[model samples]
Target chain A: MGQFILFLVLMTLGYLFGHYAEKKHYKSINKREKELLKLPVISCKNPIGNDTVAHVKLSYGSVVISVDYFKRILASLYNFFGGNIRSYETLLDRARREAILRLKESTTDADQIINLRIETSSIYKGNGNSIGSVEVLAYGTAIYFEKNEPT
Target chain B: MLMSNIEIIPNKTIVTGFGVVSGSTVRAKHAGRDLMAGLKNIFGGELKGYTELLEESREEAIKRMISQAEQMGANAIVNVRFSTSSVAAGAAEIYVYGTAVTVE
Candidate 1:
């Protein structure tokens, strides 16, 4: 009976807190995504023009986000069912997008960003029970085109 | 030395390839930073400590990789890539690899 009550309490706490966090995160992501629609980052092998005068530099963005307890419980349940555990997907998605947004935000002088790369790491600290957090890193080489002089 | 993840430098000439060079490191979160990050997590924002830890790890790996490239008589590294994995509980591994090349 004691264990049951404790479980109920954890679940309730997780539900309220998790829902609030998720909603706020989604709202922020949507707003930033809309604002950042102009600066597109891509991964391609070749540069479109043979311009050597452009300034080239690297840009990096790192994001560390935690998985809430409520989704952790739902995910473990899904794990037992032997199917896709979609709860963690949003967490990773948010991390990735946030990283990219950060990279873009820092590149005001960049004309285009290419050779993009992304890396992810999971921070697991629970006692074989759940994953605690996730970290994602997004990076790219940003090129700034220098003004061309008329020949 | 110059390093870029792209296959070729936008305008520089790559003289020769010295094959692949790589460097990696594993880091475990300390108790204090973990506790502070835990508190920060309650507010649902960026955990600066963890970010700095991973950033430091990445810099170290890249530096080692660059030193290796230099040892190979290469002035540039191209097609560089980075990857990370959870090696153990509270620990993570950062790996950086790229093709070493001599550029003109």
Candidate 2:
């Protein structure tokens, strides 16, 4: 009975805090994304023009996000049923977007970022690979244009 | 040294190619960070400690790669890539590689 009660309390706290954090993050992400709409992130290998380019540099962003107790339980229960685990979807979505945003933010002055790649992995597995966090890394080459030269 | 993930630098010409250079590092956070991350697993949020650990490890790996490139007398590294894997509980390996070359 005591163990069950502890589990219940942890789940409640997890739900409340996790929900709040997700909502807040989505709001911020949406706003920042809109503000950064001008910057183009592309997966192409080559920059279109060769003449106007000033310099190219590497840019990357990485993030680690953990799932709450409630969601972890929800996902395990989902595993038994064998379908889409909605709880984890949002976690991954947020992490990927956040990583890309950080990458864009880091090179705001660049003309464009090309050859973008995103990588994901689960890290810090505690017990039975049950308690682990998602890590997303986004990287690309940023192209800067010549400042004083004519376009 | 100039570093880019693409095969060629935008404005520079590749004068000489010195082959691939690579580096890797394995790292783990202290016990305090692990304890805090455990709590975060319950409440659900960003794990800042783990993020910092990964970033630091990646930097270290990139630095090592750069040193290797320097030994080869390369002025730039292009087509760089990064990979991470968990080798043990609480420990992660960051690996980075790139082609070292001279650009003009």
Candidate 3:
């Protein structure tokens, strides 16, 4: 009976906390994503214009995210049932978005961002108990065009 | 030195090439963050704690690379690239590299 009560308590606490974190993250991610739409990160590898000073530099954004215990319970149950563990889907989504936002933040001076690439890897990859932590990295070569022409 | 990942910069004369310059650093998270993160894991979301740790390390690596290029007397660094690796538990390494060039 004591163990059952403890399990209930943990599940409730985990649920509340997990829900709160996910909401806050989505709010922040959506806000930045809306702003990034204006700048438009591209993977074209080359920009249209010439006659400007350009610099090839690396900019990257990365996020390490994990799933909450409540979701973990659901995920493990699903695992035993041999079906999709939906809990992790959004975890990856948030990481990817956050990484892109960070990349954008780093290259505010650049006019166009070309040659963008995203790499995803599991940092902890869990210990078979739950999904631990995953990192999503977005990297790009940023080129800034010099506005004034050289004589 | 001016550093860029772009293949070429317009309107500048490439005087000479000094080859690639690189820097790397390894960093570990503090015990406080690790404990706090363990608690936060119950509710789970963005580990802002770890993010900040890696950000600082990566920036430090970039600074070191730039300084190395400066020491070589290059005006700019181009074709920069970064790589990250986890060298140990709770620690990750950030590396930045680029080509040094004299631009006129």
Computed on C-alphas against the true complex, the DockQ of each candidate is 0.40, 0.90, 0.51
lDDT of 3 by residue, B1-104 (tens): 56556655445678999998999999888899988777667768878898888778878998898888889899888777777777876788877787899988
Per-residue lDDT of model 1, residues B33-73, tens digit only? 98877654433445678888888998899989999999999
RMSD of 1: 3.5
Worst 10 residues of 3 chain B by lDDT: B2-11
How would the docking of model 3 be graded? medium
lDDT of 3 by residue, A1-151 (tens): 9999987888898889888888998998899888777566787756666645445556788888878878888888888888777788888888888898999988776666777777775655445746677777788866666662222
Interface RMSD of each: 2.9, 0.8, 2.7
In candidate 2, what are the lDDT values of residues A47-129, reduced to their tens digit? 66664888787999999999888999998899889999999999999999999999999888888889999999898675575
Worst 10 residues of 3 chain A by lDDT: A142-151
Which should have the higher lDDT, number 1 or number 2? Answer: 2
Question: Would candidate 2 be rated incorrect, acceptable, medium or high by CAPRI criteria?
Answer: high
Candidate 3 reaches a DockQ of 0.51
Model 3 global lDDT (CA atoms, 0 to 1):
0.77
**What ranges in model 3 sit over 4 Å off?**
A1-4, A49-58, A81-83, A146-151, B10-15
Which is the better candidate, 1 or 3, if ranked by DockQ? 3
Question: Would you estimate the TM-scores of all the predictions?
Answer: 0.83, 0.95, 0.82
TM-score of chain B of each: 0.94, 0.98, 0.91
